[model samples]
Target: MLLKTFGWSFAVTAIGLVAAVFYGGWTGFGVVAILSILEISLSFDNAVVNAGILKKMNAFWQKIFLTVGVLIAVFGMRLVFPVVIVAISAQLNPIDAVDLALTDKDQYQQYVTDAHPAIAAFGGMFLLMIFLDFIFEDRDIKWLAWLERPLAKLGKVDMLSVCIALIVLLISSMTFAAHAHQHGGTHVDKAETVLLAGIAGLITYLAVGGLSSYFEDKLEEEEEREHEAEEQAKRSGKQQSAVLLAGKAAFFMFLYLEVLDASFSFDGVIGAFAITNDIVLMALGLGIGAMYVRSLTVYLVRQGTLDDYVYLEHGAHYAIGALAVILLVTIQYEINEVITGLVGVVLIAASFWSSVRRNKRLAEAEGSTEGSGKAEVSSGV
Candidate 1:
């Protein structure tokens, strides 16, 4: 099962290692290895959240996710996306940006880092909404009942998630702006940019998610009509909705997944700069890590891991909430990547164990009930 599932990931890892060696000798290989591990550690929650969405999709989309999606994840976001950010933010031509990356890596890193406020504003708000919506929405299963239950109750307030997110962005921007003004800090100009970027992020989230829902509804309507016309006599009011145009749906989903990925990678890409400003090595390393993350997403979907571990999604969203808040804070200050990565990993790991314990308890109770029923039967004999 492992081999069949992760064969592609293993093959890609081997190629990445070989390429690293060829590109920069053994030192390059070591850098990519560390980069890959760093990406995986930082993105484990990403896999869980992704699986939740991917499973709702059909088989064709899932295959595309594993195949073409990996390419976009590696080259597009991990490589070209950062370059584009540099090119745009630095007001340099693409060629100049490329040159900066190749000839003067530090300059390239600075441009990308300089764009952090916009990145943080957009990504932080989008991610914050994701966390807030997840926590605030009603669910039968919850991981941190103490925290989540209250949020769930509060979810009844219309637009509560968006309101909370805006309030956070407002306070963060005002506070940071004030501090920057008082201290003559350079990043003070970020106040206005943060709000604008955050709104853009929120809009993007709404548009993509809304489009997906609209198409899904259309697909469902089409399915229901087909059932009524053809199978009405055979089966009653039963329908399994399928994508009307597999190709088109796959295309949109591909785009949606890429956007979602880019949001998640914002922090990772920035954090990589903290380690090293070598864009080439950063791309190669983070790219390899992204491939593994895609593989893990597929694994979770195929194995039905989300269904097995009910609280896994809750934990992943909670981690996202932490990261979102951290991103906003990072707009004002530097935070150690280790702390950020650890917070996410720890939340997910703790949730995994909680799930395991719950499963064991349920199994024991079930076994005892079965034993009691059998005893009654034997006594009658």
Candidate 2:
């Protein structure tokens, strides 16, 4: 099962490593490997979250995610995104941007760094909305019942999530972005840029996420109707076709996933320069990590891992909330990538452990109940 799931990922890794060696020798190979590991470590929560959404999609959509989505993730975000940012920021043409990235990596890195505030603001707000919406929704399974219950209750208030997100954006803009400074440079008030970018992010999330949810709900309604029809047919000894997400619903969901991925990649793209400024190396390395993440998402869906580990989604969202806060904080202050990755891993691990304990306790209770019933039956006999 493991080989079947991860065979393509392994192939990509081998190919990327070989190419990296040819491009920059063993040093390049080492950097690519480290970057791959780094991307995987940082985005593990992302995979969990992706699985939760992807499970609802039909097999065809899932295939599209693997093939087309991989291209967007690899070349579009990991490679072209930085170059595009540099071109716009540095007032250079696309050709010049590519040349600059290949020839003058320091300048390329600088242009990318200069754009970080806007990037952070945009990605942070988008991810913040995701975390907010997740926590606000009342679910049958709550990982942290003490907090989630109260939050879910508050969710009853119309647009409470939006209100809270806006408040955070306002505070972050006023406090952090107001006096943010570049390295060895004086304070530069980026409050306006942060505010605009954050609003754009928030709007994008609302538009894309809202549309996706609307269509998905429609799909669910249609599926429920089909389910009723199927039941009726079953009673009559007739066959009914299966339901699937299609048309506008699948398209918007695909768009939502792509945007969500872009938000997740914002930090990683910026942080990749800390390891290496070679665009090709970053793309190859992060692309391999991305393939593994996609594979993990598929495995989780097929294996029903989320169904067994009910609290896993909760943990991923909490990690996302923490990452949103970290992104906002990083607008003003430098944060170690190690701390970023560690926070997510720790949260997920703790949640997984809690889930195990919950399962064990439930099993023990069931055993006791069964034993008591048997004793009572024997007594009666």
Candidate 3:
């Protein structure tokens, strides 16, 4: 399983590197590959969190994710998003902004940097709310009688979550609007940009996130119905067949994975400004980031590693929450992209090590139980 996962990832990486080499030679290819690996390492938690969500999606959506979804991720978010950011924040025509990016690489880099404050404010605060909501939200799974009622009640109506999001949006808008006015002066109206960005973020949160959640719930209901049908078939002494077809299953997982990938890519897409903004480099670096994220998702699923590392998901969500806070703070203060990535890596690494120790202890306990059972059997004989 490990070999297959590694082999597939290596092949994908090689393809991406080759494309980069053709576009910008060995130097460009090397840079992108390294950056991609770094992005992937920093985003392991993203894959785990995605898997938790993907498990709830329907099969058809998952297929859309693996195919068209990849296009959106590799191109839409990575290539187009930065350009869009620059165009909107700088008050330039989108075409002109993109042309500048393709033609005058240095100026384009500056534009992206100039635009980063707003991007960070919008995407950062939005992501922060997601993390905090997930963390503080009660998610207790109950099988008993009385315990299930309160746990179910806690699950409904995320009031605190809505309040936190509103606060982040208010703070982020005020700060970015002020920063934009300070830097761009007359060229860009800070208040207008901040207002637009805050609106954009709110819309994205409601549209993308709300839709994804709705679809996910619908899929879960369908899956439950199917499971019930399978149970009935079994009780009737009929042949037990696989109710969830592989293609269908793969499609749903793929779709949810793609949306999840897009959500996570918002930071890297925005952060690419810190590096050289040559459309080529942004595409290369961010593409590598996307590729690695895809590979990591597949690796996690194939390995069932999340099952072993119980706290891995928790850690990743926590890191997401931290990144969101850092992003929001950067609206007023400059937070380095490298630092953001490192914080996530450190947290995830700690969680992974914790999982490893936990598994080792479980194994030892099982071994001790088997040994005692063997001794008892011999004495009885």
* Maximum-lDDT candidate: 2
Candidate ranking (TM-score, best to worst): 1, 2, 3
Q: What are the per-residue Cα lDDT tens digits for candidate 1 across 1-381? A: 788777877887898889889977987777677667767756766787678768767787787777877777788778986666557555779788889888876677676567666666777777788778888998888787888788789999999988888898898778753333212335556678778877877886677667656655655655456555446545656543434444455555556666666656754564454444466777887887887788788888888765676666666677777878877777777776556656766877788799899999999999999999999999999
- Model 2 ranges off by over 4 Å: 13-65, 81-95, 221-285
Candidates in order, TM-scores: namely 0.78, 0.76, 0.71
Instruction: Give the whole-model CA lDDT for all candidates, comma-separated.
Output: 0.72, 0.76, 0.63
- Residue 90 local lDDT, model 2: 52
Q: Which 10 residues in a row give candidate 2 its minimum summed lDDT?
A: 240-249
Query: With candidate 3 superimposed using the best TM-score fit, by how many Å does residue 1's alpha carbon deviate from the native?
Result: 5.3
**Model 3: per-residue lDDT, tens digit, 193-302?**
55566567656766667666765665566567667767887899786555454344455555555566666676565444433345666676777677666666666655
Winner on TM-score (2 vs 3) = 2
TM-score of 1: 0.78
How far is 323's C-alpha from truth in model 1 (Å)? 1.2
- Off-target runs (Cα >4 Å) in candidate 1 are 14-65, 178-188, 232-282, 297-306
User: Superposing all C-alpha atoms, what RMSD in Å does each candidate have to the true structure?
Assistant: 4.9, 4.6, 6.1
In terms of lDDT, model 1 sits at 0.72
- Worst lDDT 10-window in candidate 1: 176-185
Q: Please identify which of the two predictions, 1 or 3, would achieve the higher TM-score against the true structure.
A: 1
